[model samples]
Structures are given as C-alpha cells and as structure tokens.
Target: MHRFANPAQFNRLADAILPWATGAFVLLLGAGLYYAFFDSPPDYQQGESVRVMYIHVPAAWMAMFTYMVMAVASFTALVWRHPLALLAGRAAAPIGAVFTALALITGMLWGKPMWGTYWVWDGRLTSVLVLLFLYLGYMALWQAIDEEEKAGRAASILALVGVVNIPIIKFSVDWWSTLHQPASVMRLDGPTIDGSMLMPLLLMAGAYQAYFAVVFLWRMKLEINRRKLAVARQVSMHAPVGAE
Candidate 1:
C-alpha cells in the first residue's frame, strides 16, 4: 500500500489497470443485460414488473457498498494519514450519489406496479433516502471549503459520523414493519430466489462494481492532477520575479 503512495507510481498503476477494467465492465454489463432482459424468468406474483428488480436491487447494493468504501477511506485518512485516502472518499461521493438516486428511481418504478404507489414512507425506503442525503452532504462539504486539507478533514469526519446510517438502512426492513420485502437472497435459510434470476442479478452486480472501479480511478487521477497544478501555481506565485 505504501509503495503505491507516490502519485507517479499510483498514476502508472491506474493507467495499466484502466484498460482492462473498462473492457471487463463492457463485457460484464452486456452479458448481464442480456440475461436480465432475455433469459431470466419473471416473478410468479409480480410478473413483468419484476424485471425492474435487476436494476433496483443492484443499485441499492452499490449505493450502500460505495458508502462503505468511502467510510473506510475516511477512516484511513483520519487514522493513518494516508494521502490518497481522502481523495478516494471524495471520488466515491458522486458515484455513490448517482447509484443512490438510481436505487430510488428504480424502486419507485418497481413499486408502482406492485404496491399501487410510486412512493412510500417504508423504513427501508426512508433510510436509503437518508443515505442519499448523506452522500450529497459529504460532497457538499468538500466543495464548501476552499482549503483541500481542511475540506478533506471536514468531509472525512462527516463520513465517519454517517457510517452509523448504513446499518440503519440495512436492518430497517427487519426491524420495522415496512412495505419493502425482507432479504431473500441473504437469509439464514439460504436464497429464496431461483438460480435463473439470481445469476443475472449477480452478473449485474459485478457490472456495477466494475463501473464504480473505473469511474473511481478516473476521478482520483483527476483530483491528484488538479492538486498538482494548484501546487505548481502557488510555487510560481511565491517565486522571485526573475527566478527560473
């Protein structure tokens, strides 16, 4: 980990991995979509409307998964003072926000057909909404402060505090009576979903993970370059007029 701490080394590593990541993302996404739309059987109860689950479930998973990544990165930045950690947290914010929004939108679309309403105050729904707001607030904190280090510290703290919301989101379905369905795939008894549906679901999840990785690395690289440019300008401003 420390060996890749140098920006130049990290950039080289990113460049090497990016092409393969992008290729895998495209392949997996294509395969997942094919299975989701063409191969997977519809739910016995929900019928055609169940197809929306392919998108909604994976987005919800990634929404929480991305936050966990950000929180871990924040912890690293705060404790170990890892220079890239804060940048990673910042990079993940927008991606997580987008995934959260997708989850909400897809949930609404899925709900209208099954639940007779597009929106609900269900515990899981409300908690996931709160998770979305946390992502927005985390990103806003970074933009609100001008100093990079100060913003990173503030954002890191907020992220750490927001980590509490994750469990609330996860367990809300079990803890409260809600319109949302309880865990089928992750239950102690074993997955209730058929293998036909589960295969596509897992594939879509892989695609989403790959997509996040590619976008995250790109964002981190851009942030690092932006900081380097800022430092260069600051040095120039402080240099003697005739200095080379």
Candidate 2:
C-alpha cells in the first residue's frame, strides 16, 4: 500500500490500469444491456418495467460502494496522513453523488410503474435520499473550504460520520415496513434471482465497477496534478522577486 503512496508510482499504476478498466466497462456494459433487454425474461408481475431494476440496482449499489470507498479513504487520510488517500476521497465524492442521483431517479421511475406513485416516504427510499444528501454535503464541504488540507480534513470527517448511513440504506426495508423490496440477490444463502436475469444484472454491476475505476483513477490523477500545480504556484509566489 505504501509503495503506491508516491504520486508518481500511483500515476504509473493508474495509467497501466485505465485502459483495461475502460475496455472492461465497454464490454461489460454492452453484454449487460444485451442480456437485460434482449435475452432476459420479464417479470411476471411488473413485466417490462422490471427492466429498470438493471440500471437502478447497479447505480444504488455503486452509490453505497463508492461511499464506502470514500469513507475508507477518509479514514486512511485521517490516520495515515497520506495525500493520496485524501485525494481519493475527494475524487470519489462527485462520482458517488452522480450515482446516488441516478439511483434515486431510476427508483422513482420504477416506483411509479409498480407502486402507482412517483414518490414515497418509505424507509429504503428515504434512507437512500439521505445518502444522496450526505454525498452532496461531503462535496460541498470540500468546495466550501479553500485550503486543500483543511478541506480534506473537514470532508474526511463528514465522510466518516456518514458511514453510518450505508447500513441504514441497506437494511431499511427489513428494519421498517416499506414498499421497497427486500434483498434477493445478496441473500446469505444465495441469490434468489433467476440465472437468466442474474447474468445481465451481474454484468451491469461489473460494468459499473469498471466505470468507477476508470473515472476514479482519472480523477485521482487530475487531483494530484492540480495539487502539484498549486504547490508550484505557491513556491513561485514566495520566492524572492529576482530569484529563480
């Protein structure tokens, strides 16, 4: 882990991985979409609307997953004082926020078809909404603070604090009476979803994960370069007027 702490090393690693991640994302997404729309059978109850689950579920999963990544990175930043860790947390925020929004929107689309309403105050729905807010708050905290270290510290604290929301989002259906469906694919015993539908779902999930990696690596590299540029500017400003 520490071997990759050096920005140059991390950047080289990222460059190596980016192409693979991008290719995987493209392949998986194509396969997932083919299976989702063309191959898989529709739900008996929900029929065509069930297709939304492919997008909604993966987005929701990524939302939580990205937050977990951010929180862990935040913990690493806070404890190890690694600039890479802090940059990682910062890089993940916007991605997580976008995924959260996609989940919410797709959930609402699915809800209207199945539940006969576009909005609900259900436990799962509400908890997911809160998760979105937490993402936004975390990003806003980063933007609100000017100093990189101070912003990283503040945002990292918020991220760690928001870690509690992940479980609540996961278990909201079981914890409270809600219209939201309970876990099917993630059961302790095994996934209950039929193999036909499961293949596409899993493919989509892989695509999402790959997409995240590609974007995250890009963002981390960008953040690192931006920080370097900022440091260069600071050094130039502080240098004697006639000195190099």
Candidate 3:
C-alpha cells in the first residue's frame, strides 16, 4: 500500500492493467449480451421484460460495489494518508453515481411492466435512491471546498458516514414488504436463479467489473496529472519575478 503512495509507480501499474481491463470489458460485454438475448430463456412469470434484469441487477451490484470501494479507499486515505486512495475515492464517485442512476432507471422500466407502475417508495428502491444522493453529496463536498486536502478530507468523511446505507440497501427487501423482489442470485443456499439465466447475469457482472477497472485506472491517471498541473501553477504563481 505504501508503495502505491508514489504517483509514478501507480501510473505505471495503471497503464499496464488498463489494456487488459479494456479488453476484458469488451469481451465480457459481447459474451454477456449474446447469452442474455439468445441463450437465456425468458422468465416464466415476467416474460420477455425479464431481459432488463441482465442490466438492472448488474448496475445495482456495481453501484454498491463501487461505493464500497470508495469507502475503503476513503478509510485508507484518512488513516494512512495514502495519496492515491484519496484520488481513488474521488474517481469512483461519478462512476458509482452513474451506476446508481442506471439501476434506478432500469428498475423503473422493469417495474412498469411487472408492478403496473413506473415508480414506488419501496424499501429497496428508496435506499438505492439514497445511495445515489450519497454519491452526489460526496462529489459536491469536494467541489465546495477550495483547498484540495480539505476537500478530500470532507469527502472521505462523508463516504465513511455513508457506509451504513449499503447494508440497508441490501437488506431492505427482506426487512420490509416491498414491491422489489428479494435476492435470487446471492443467496446463502447458492443462487435460486437457474443456470441458464445465471450464466449471462454473471457474465454481465464480470463485464461491469472490468468496465470499472478500465475507467478507474484512466480516471486515476487523469487526477494525478491534474494535481501535478495544479502544483506547478501554484509554484509559478509564488515564484520570484523572472525566476524560471
């Protein structure tokens, strides 16, 4: 972990992993789509609309997974002062927000056909919405503060505080009588879903994971360069007249 404290080392590592991440994302997405549409059978109850599950479930999972990543990175940044950890949290916020939003939208689309409505104040749905707000709030704190370290500190604290929400989102369906369905794929007894459906679902999930890695590495590198530029400008501004 201390070794990654050096930006140059992390940048080189990110570069090395980026190509493989991107390739995996493309291959997994292709395979997942093919399996989802052609290989997987339609839900006996939900009919063809079940197709949306391939996207919605994975997006929801990624949203929570990304938030967990941000929370852990935030903890590392706050506790160990890991430079890249702070940037990792910052880079993950927008991606998590996007995933949360995608989950919400797809859930609504899936809901309209099954539940006779496009929206609901169900436990699972509401908690997931709150997750989205948490992501937005995390990003907003960074923008609101002028000082970089202060901003990162504020964002990290918010992220740690928001950790409580993740479990609530996961258990909401079981804890309350909601329109949202309970867990099918992540059960302790091993996935309740059939093998045919499970294959594409897992594939899509793998694709989402790879996609996150590719984007995260790219964003981390961009943040590193942006910070470098900021430091250079600050030094130039404070330099003596004609000091080159």
Quote the positional error of residue 108 for candidate 3 in Å: 0.4
With a 3 Å backbone cut-off (N, CA, C), the pairs that clash in candidate 1 are none
Q: Which ten residues in a row have the lowest lDDT in candidate 3?
A: 182-191
Ranking by lDDT: 3, 2, 1
lDDT of each: 0.85, 0.87, 0.87
Cα misplacement distance, residue 77 of candidate 2 (Å): 0.4
After the best TM-score superposition of candidate 1, give how far the Cα of residue 226 lies from its true spot, in angstroms. 1.0
Writing each residue's lDDT as its tens digit, candidate 3 over 51-81 gives 8999999999999999999999999999998
Residue 10 lDDT in candidate 1? 82
Q: Where is model 2 poorest over a 10-residue stretch in terms of lDDT?
A: 182-191
lDDT of 2 by residue, 1-244 (tens): 2433599899999999999999999999999999999999997777998799899899999998999999999999999998889999999999999999999999889888677788766666778888999999998899999999999999999899888656766586446643444532222124367888889999999999999999999999999988888887997999998897
Give the TM-scores of the predictions, in the order they appear: 0.89, 0.89, 0.89
